[model samples]
Target: MNMSVPFSLLFTLIILFLSVLISSTSAKKPGDASQDLVRSSCVHASYPNICLRSLSSYSGPANTPGEVAQAAVKVSLSRARKASNYLANLRSQSKREQGAFHDCVEQMGDSVDELSKTLSELKHLRSGSFRWQMSNAETWVSAALTNEDTCLDGFKEVTGKVRSDVKRKVTNLARVTSNALYLINRLDQSRQKTP
Candidate 1:
């Protein structure tokens, strides 16, 4: 009876151990794969937190490096468009900073155009033409980033609520653009590695 009890107890312990191990392993595999993908992609970003936050929401569909890059570009394009609209609204309300607001609006418009070009270039990114496409995208995105900086620079001479508001919008747009550029570079590197 003692021997049977000990065997039963050991059998139960073994089963429990196996169950725990299986559950732990299974639980980690899916989440780890997604997290690893996000971490690895974000590793190449200038703003990893922005990259992670922007891309993690689309982790399910953006499993590959290219997909992640595309998602980042889309996010960047959306941000730029929104910033452009906000700047336009602020430009209309500006009385003291009217000249500054006009210049900033023009810069924001240019930034939006550059971002659009980046998105268009990314769409043409294939393995065969990866270099050319990525180069175009990098150039356009860099220009967009520069334009955002220029917009902020224009605001340097102005003071008040309009300057602050436009600066905030442009800064956020610049961060998103920077994130997109990093992801694009990552995608290019990943493509180069493939056989």
Candidate 2:
């Protein structure tokens, strides 16, 4: 009789433990799961905080490394577009620094195009074509980042309100583009190490 009581108590405890475990695991929201993925993937990035900040705003959960890379590219595209528009507006307003503003506008336009190409390549990345697609995307994003730097370089001699304005926008875009590149490189490395 005593053994039967102990067995029943032990079974009850086991059942309780399993219930708690199941509830805890199931209680995690999709957002929480994706956030975990984001954090883990960002650990591989050069600028982890920027990567997380830029990608965490994506509406759906980025469940895979590819999804995270896609999100990063999208964020880069959006930032590049904004920078292009800002430079275009600055070019229109420029009276004294026409040459510098024009050059910056052209460089930013190129940067936007490169970023768009990166996004396009990333969008088409499939399991069978991961390496080649990632390589192309990386090249495009790197070129975009270079263009942003070149835009700032064009303003080295020009010191005025125009330089300051262009500098601010270009710097912001460059940082975001750099973050995207880091994430892409991370994704590539991670995939290579898998299987």
Candidate 3:
């Protein structure tokens, strides 16, 4: 009897549980969405211009933190799993897609720092006792704090000791890749129409 199937199922269940926990922690509390907590939202979406750059441009020395790209995004699934486990043990924050996000944040170093700081500030605003009461506020705060630390820590771990900007460029590339794919699909459809 091969146990791989059952083991695979078990592993999946564990990841799902972790994912649920992380998502629950990240959900916008009643306090988060209200006027009391409202903050600006910006265009963080991946743009197509970055995608057009050659892979050579994106590649950088793994140890050197350079502008645009400083670290290599060579993370594997197993490494991602380890990162998620580390984050899950942090006891305060929840990282949705903890595994995947670890990689993303590593690739988004400076961007991650800025994003974390912004999120941390938003968290502080909501946790203020003056805001309308929301259940799990304490849990939420703990999670936010944990996430802030985790973002910094994860950035370090995945960047292979490179600067934060390297991570940011990696994250930016992901968005650009998505945008490129979308454009390619659109072009393909248009070409089909020409026939």
Q: Which structure among the candidates has the greatest lDDT?
A: 2
TM-scores of the models, in the order given: 0.85, 0.79, 0.22
Q: Candidates sorted by TM-score, descending order?
A: 1, 2, 3
**Ten consecutive residues with minimal summed lDDT in candidate 1?**
87-96
Flag the better candidate by lDDT, 2 or 3.
Answer: 2
Per-residue lDDT of candidate 3, residues 74-147 (tens digit): 21112223433443443322343355355434533433343333223323433244133222322332333343
Q: How would you encode candidate 1's per-residue C-alpha lDDT over 92-136 as one tens digit per residue?
A: 445547777777778878888888888787767676787998888
Q: How much lDDT does each candidate structure score?
A: 0.80, 0.80, 0.35
List candidate 2 stretches off by more than 4 Å: 1-26, 91-96
Error of 3 at 146 (Å): 23
Q: Per-residue lDDT tens digits of candidate 2, residues 1-195?
A: 454658789999999999999999889875887899898888757777777787888775488877877787788778878877877776434454677678777887888788888878877878898888888888988998888998898888777777788788788778778878887888898889989
Cα lDDT of candidate 1 equals 0.80
Error of 2 at 31 (Å): 0.8
The TM-score between candidate 1 and the true structure equals 0.85
RMSD in Å for all candidates: 2.7, 4.5, 23.2
